[model samples]
Target chain A: MQTKRMTFSSRWLPYALLAPQVLITVVFFIWPASQALWQSMLRQDAFGLRTTFVWFRNFERLFDNPLYLASMKTTAIFAISTTLLAMSLSLLFAVMVNRMLRSREWYTTFLVWPYAVAPAIAGVLWWFMFNTSVGIVPYMLEGFGYDWNHRLDGNDAMILVVLAAAWKQISYNFLFFLAGLQSIPQSLLEAAAIDGAGRTKRFWTIVFPLLSPTTFFLMVVNVVYAMFDTFGVIHATTEGGPAQATNILVYNVFRDGFVNGNLGASAAQSVVLMGIVVVLTVVQFRFIERRVNY
Target chain B: MVENDRFGSLLAHLILILGVAAVVFPVYVAVIASTHAPGTFLQGVMPLLPGSHAIENYRTVIFEGRAQAGAPPIGLMLWNSFVMAMMIAVGKIAISLLSAFAIVYFRFRFRIFFFWVIFLTLMLPVEVRIVPTYAVVANLGLLNSYAGLSIPLIASATATFLFRQFFMTVPEEMLEAARVDGAGPMKFFKDILLPLSITNIAAMFVIMFIYGWNQYLWPLLVTNDERYYTVVMGIQRMVTGGDSEPLWHLVMATVVMAALPPILVILFMQRLFVKGLVETEK
Candidate 1:
C-alpha cells in the first residue's frame, strides 16, 4: 500500500497507464469468475432447450455425489503427499548443499534445471519410466517381488501421479529451501556447536525453527500446486484414471465442462475452486503480513 | 569442536551427489530412450544405453511430426511456444510497468482503488475459472489464434507488485532531478526509471518466459487446430496416439525438444531466474 514520497501531478496520464491492465483484468479474470458464479445456479437440458434456475442444486448434487467426494479425498492425499515428498527431499538436499564448500553450485544447478520441465512433460518422463512393460522402475520393482502396473491398479496409478507431480515440483521447493538455508546465519550454528550440540542437534534446535517460515510457505504453495497445477501431470500421465483414483478437483471441472458437457455442474465446481483459491490467497497474504514482523 | 571434519564433508558430498543423480535420472532416461530404435521398446525393458537413432528421431519429429496423432511438426510447435512466451513476457512486463509507475509516482484519485482492482487478479488463477474464461475467449473469436494463445495470459498482478515494490526503493531524488531538468514524465520514465529497472526486468523476463512456455492446459483448451498447438500440450497427443503403444523413440525425442528451450533458459539465466522467483514471492 506504500506509494512514492515525492509525487508526479499527472491526471490523465495515470488513467491511460492503468487502462490496459484494468481492461484485461475485467475481461479475462473478473468477468469469467462472475460468469462462473451465475452459471452455477442455472442448469440447462441436454438439448439446450429448457433452462431452470435451481440455486445451489449443482453444489448439492456435487456433495451428494460419491465421485466428487472421492475427488476431494484424492486431492487431499495428493496435496499432502506431494508437499511432504517435494519439501522433504528439497530440504535434505538444501541442508546437504548448505554444508558443502566447493560443489554447491554444481549440485544446485543439477537439481534446479528440473524446474524448467513442464508439468506434463515431467509426467510423461515419469510415466515412461513406470510404464509396467517397458519401464525401468517397474522392472526394478518387480525384481523385489512386487508388481508395478499403473495401467490397471488404482494404487499404482496414484503413486505414479504422485511421483510425477513431486518430480516436477522438487526444483521449485529446492530453490526456496536452498535460499532459506543460505539465509540462515552461520553464527547461530557456530554458537550451537560451541555449546557442545552436535550437527543433528543444531539442525533440530536452531536451523529448523529458523526455517519454519519458509517451510510453512512452501507447504501452502505446494498444496495449491498439487491441487491446481498438477492437472497437466494427471492429464498427460494418468488422465485421472484407473477408476478415478487420481481425480483432483481441477481435472474434474475440466472433465465435467468439456468432456461431459455438464456445464452447470462444471460452473459450480469452478465456483468451489474459486472459493478455495480465495481462502488460500487470504492465508498466503495474511501469513506474509505476519512474516514481515518475524 | 571448530575443526574441519573430513568425514562430515565426505558424507555431505555423497548425499549431494546421490541427490543430483536422482534428479537427473529421469531426463537421462528420456534422452537415452530418444536415441533408441522404435523396435527396441517393444522387446521388454527400455534400453539403458544411447542408441544410434537420435538424429533420425529428432529429425522426424521436428520436420514431419507424428501425423497419426494429429500433432504438428515440432519445428512449428516450438516456434509457436517461443512466440507465445515472448509475447506474454513483453506484454505483461509493459502493462505491469506502466501500471506500477502510475500507482507509485502519481497521486491520482482512485490510485488505491486501481491497485486493489489489479490485485484482484492475484486471487483467481485461470484454472479456477476455466470454463467461463474459455467462453470469453471463444466469444472474442480468439480460438486457434496466436492472440488467443498469449493475450489472455498477459495480465500479471505479480509483475505489477514486483515493480511497484522495486520502484518504492528508488530514491525520490531521481524524480526531483528529472523534473528540475525539465523532462516530462514520459521522458523521465524512459530515461531514469527504465534503465534503473533493466536487471529487474531481465530477471522478470526469465521467470515469465518459463511460465508462458510451460502453460499446458490453457493452450490445450483454447487451441484445437494443429497449427496453433504448443509443444507442451502437443506432447499429450503424441503419447496417447491410438493404442499400439506410443512410438517411444520419437515420443521421447518430442519430450526432449519440447522441454529444451525452457531448460536452456533456466540453465543460462539461473541467477536471474532465482532472483525473480524469490523477489516476486516476497
Candidate 2:
C-alpha cells in the first residue's frame, strides 16, 4: 500500500513490460471469450456459413434439446461424485503419509507420480484396464463367470470416469494436504494425547478442524477440475458414446462446436458452463472464506 | 509417548504402505506392460519383471513405424510436440516473468485491476473458450501451424500470478541496493532478480512445459491436418482410427514413450515438484 512517486519514464515502464502480455491476452484470451459470448446470441444462416443475430434463441433451443439437458445432469453428477471421491482419498493418503516418521519421502513421491501423467494417457490406461476383452480385471471377472461392461452401462461408465479422475487428482490434493498437515503445530496434538483422548477423538477435535482450510481449498479446486479438466479423459475413453453416457458439459461443448459445427449451440453451452462454474466458485468462496483462519 | 502410541504409529505405517502400493501398482503394471511382447500384452499375462522387449517396443513406436503406420509420421509428431512445447514454455515464462516483475517491482496505476483480470482468466477453462478460440485461430490463418497452437497459450495468467506471488516475497533491500548501484530496471532484473529466481523459474518452466505438452482438445480442434498433431493428439488418432481390434500393444507403447520425458523429469526433480505445489497452495 505504500505509494512510490514515479517519474514519467518509470511510469511508462510497467506498461511497456505489460505490453506483450496484454496484447496476447487481448488477441487470444479476451477475444475468444468475447467471441464465444457473441456466438451464443447468433443463429447460423441458410448456407450454414453465414450468421444472423438471434438474441437468446440459441439459449432457448439449448433448453429444448433433450441431449443438452441430459448432459447438464451428467455434468453435475460427474462433478459432485469426482470431487467428493478425490477429496476423501487425498485426505486419507495425506494423513497416512504425514503420520509416517520413516520412508515418508518415498511414500510422498509415489503418491505424486500419478499427477505427472497426461490425462489422455491416463484415460487410455484406464480404458485398457477396463476393456472387457484385454483388460486383466475383466478377464479375471470373466474367469469367475461374472459379466462386466463399463462401456455399455451408464452408471458403470460414470463410476469408471469418476474413478479415473479421482485417481489422477488424489496426488495434487494430497500434496497440498500433506503440506497443510505438516504446517500444523505438533504440540497441540501432543497435548491432546496427554489428555488421554483417543486417536479418533484427537483427530476430530484437533487435527480435523485445523485442516479444514486446506480441505475447503482442495474442494474448490477438485470440483472445478472435475467439471472442466476431465474433458480429455471423457473424450478419449467414451467419445461421449454408448448413448452419450459419459458426455459431460465440456465434452458436449467440444462435440457440438468442433465435431458437429454447431458453433452457436456450443457457445451457448459454454456460456452456461461458465455461469455454473462462476456461481459455484462464488458460493464456495463465500462459504469457506469466513471459516478459514490464518 | 507410551507403548500403545508406538503401536498406533506402526499401524499408521502399515496403512501408508498399503496406500502407496495402491497408488503405484497401476504405473508398475504399465511399465511392465511396456516391456512385454504384443501377444503377451494382449493376452493380459502378468509380467512381474521387465522383459527384454522394451527396446523393441521403443523402436516400434519411434522408428519402426508400427504405432500408427499410415498416419502422420511418428518422428514428425515428436518433433512437432517438442518444438511446440519449447516455444510455449519459453513464451509463458518470459511473459509471466515480465508481468510478474511489473506487478511486484514497479509502481503502476490499476495494478490491482490488472492483477484481478489476470487471476480471473484462471477460472475460465479452455473448454469455455474453445469455440471462440477456434474462431480466432481460423481467422488468423494460423490453423494447423505451430504458431496457432503455441501463441494462444503463451500468455498464461496462472504463471504470472505465481511469479508475482513469489516476487512479492523478495526482500526490498535487494532491489534498493541494485538501484543504488546505478543499475537500470532491466539491468537490475537481469543481474539480481533473474539469478535469485532460478528455482521458481525452473519450477514454472517444467509445469508450463508439461501443460503445453499435455494439451489435447485445443490442438485437436485448432489443427485439422494430421501433420500438426502433438504426441497426445497422435495417440488419440491411433485409438480412434482403427476398426480392427484395439492395438493395445502399440497404444501402450506410444503412451509409455510419450510419458517418458515427464516421468524422468519428475523422478529427478521430485523435490522441486513438491515444493512448487506447496508454494502455490500457500
Candidate 3:
C-alpha cells in the first residue's frame, strides 16, 4: 500500500500505464470469473433451448452427487499425498545436499532441472515408465508378483498420477528447501553438536524445527500446486480414468465444463474452486505478511 | 565445523548420489527411449541404455509427425511453444513493469483499486475459470492463434508484486535526483529504473519463460488447429491421439525436445531462476 514519498502527480499518464494490465484482467479474468458466478445459478434445459434460474440447484446437486463428492475426496487425498511426498523427499535431498562441501552445486544442478519439465511431460515420462504393457516400473513390479495396470486398477492409476505429480514437484520443493536450509545459521547446529547430540538428534532438535517456516510455506504452495497445477498430470496420463479415481477438482472442472459441456454444473464447480483459491491466497498472503514481520 | 563424523559425510554423499539418480531417472529413460527403434518398445521392458536409432527417431518426430496421431511436426510445435513462451514472458514483464511503476511512482485516483484488481488475478488462475475465459477469447475470435495462446495467460500478479517490491527497495534519491535534473517520470523510468531492473527482469524472464513453456491445459483447450499446438500439449496428443500404442521412440524424442529448452534455461541461468523463484514467493 505504500508508495514513494516523492511521488509524481500525473493525470492521464498513470491511467495509460495501468490500462493494458487492467484491460486484460477485466476482460480475461474478472469478467469471466463474474460470468462463472452468474452462470452457476442458471440451468439450461436438455435441448439447450430454455434456461431456468435455479438458485443453488447446481451446488446442491453437486454435494448430493456421489461422483462430485468422491472427486472432492479424491482431490484431498491426491493433494495431501503429493505435498507430503514431494516435501519430504525434497527436504531429505536438501538436507543431504546442504551437508556437502564440494558437490553441493553439482547435486543441486541435477535435481533442479526437473523444475523446468512440464507437468504433462512429467506425467508422460512416468506413464511410459509405468506403462502397463512394457513400462520398466511395471516390469520391475511384476518381479515381485504385483500386477501393475493403471488402466483397470483405480489404485494403480492414483499411485501412477501421484508419482508423476510428486516427481515434477520435487525440484520446486527442493529449491525452496535448499534455500531454507542454507539460511539456517551453522552456529546453532554446532552448539547442539557440542552438547553431545548425534547427527540424527541434531536434525530433529535443531534442523527440522528451524526449517518449519519453510516447511509450512512449501506445504501451502505444494497443496495449491497439487490441486490446480497438476491438472496436466491427470489430464495427460490418467484422463481421470479407471472410474474417476484420479479426477482432482481442477481436472473435474475442466472435464465437466469443456469436455462434457455441462455449463451450469461446471460453473458451479469453478465458483467453488475460486472460493478455495481465495482462501488459499488469503492464507498465503497472511503467512507472507507474518514472515515479513519476522 | 561440527563434529567431524567421517561416517556422516560418507552417508551424505551416498544419499545425495541416490537422490540425484532418482531425480534424473525419468528423463534418462526418456532419452534412452527416444534413441531406440519403434520395435524395441513393443516386446519387453524399456532398455536402460541409449540405442542406435537416435538420429532416425529424432528426425522422424522433428520433420514427419505421425499423421495418424494428428500431431504436428516437433519442429513447428517447438517454434510455436517458443513464440508463446516469449510473448507471455515479455508481455507479462512489460505490462507489469509499467503498472508497478505507475503504482509506485505516481499517486493517482483508484490506485488501490487497480492494485487489488491485479491482486485478484492470483486467485483466478486459468484452471478455475477456464470455461468463461475460453468463451471470452472465443467471442473475440482468438482461438487457434498465438494471441489466444499467450495473451489470456499474460496478466500476472506475481510479476507486478515482484516489481512493486523491487521498486520500493530502490533508493528515493534516484527519483529526486532525476526530478531535479528536469527528467520526467517516463525518462527517469527508461533511463534509471529499467537499467537498475535488468537483473530482476532477466530473472523473471527465466521463470516466466518456463511457466509459459510448461503450459498444457490452456493450449489444449484453445487450439484445435495443429499450427498453434505447442510442444507440451502436442506431446499429450501424440500419446493419446493414435489408436495403436504411441510410437514410443518418436514420442520420447519429442518429449526430450519439448522439455529441453526450459531445462537448459534453468541449468544455464540457475542463479537467476532461483532468485526469481525465491523472490516471487516473498
Residue B89's lDDT within candidate 1 is 98
The C-alpha lDDT values of all candidates are 0.91, 0.79, 0.92
- TM-scores vs. true structure, each candidate: 0.99, 0.93, 0.99
The number of clashing residue pairs in each candidate reads 0, 0, 0
lDDT of 1 by residue, A1-294 (tens): 677787888769999999999999999999999999999999998899999999999999999999999999999999999989999999999998877767888888898998899999989999999988899998999889999988889899998888888988888998898889889888888888988998889889999999999999999999999998988999999998889999999999999999998999999999999899889999999899999998
- CA lDDT, candidate 3, residue B218: 94
Q: List candidate 2 segments past 4 Å from native.
A: A1-11, A143-145, A280-293, B1-7, B41-52, B66-70
Q: Indicate whether candidate 2 or candidate 3 has the larger DockQ.
A: 3
Calculate the i-RMS of every candidate, to one decimal place: 1.2, 2.8, 0.9
Which candidate has the top score in DockQ?
3
Scored against the native two-chain complex, candidate 3 gets a DockQ of: 0.88
> Where does candidate 3 chain B have its weakest 10-residue lDDT segment?
B64-73
DockQ of 1: 0.83
Q: Mind giving the per-residue lDDT tens digits that candidate 2 earns over B217-241?
A: 8888877786798888778877777
TM-score of chain B of each: 0.98, 0.87, 0.98
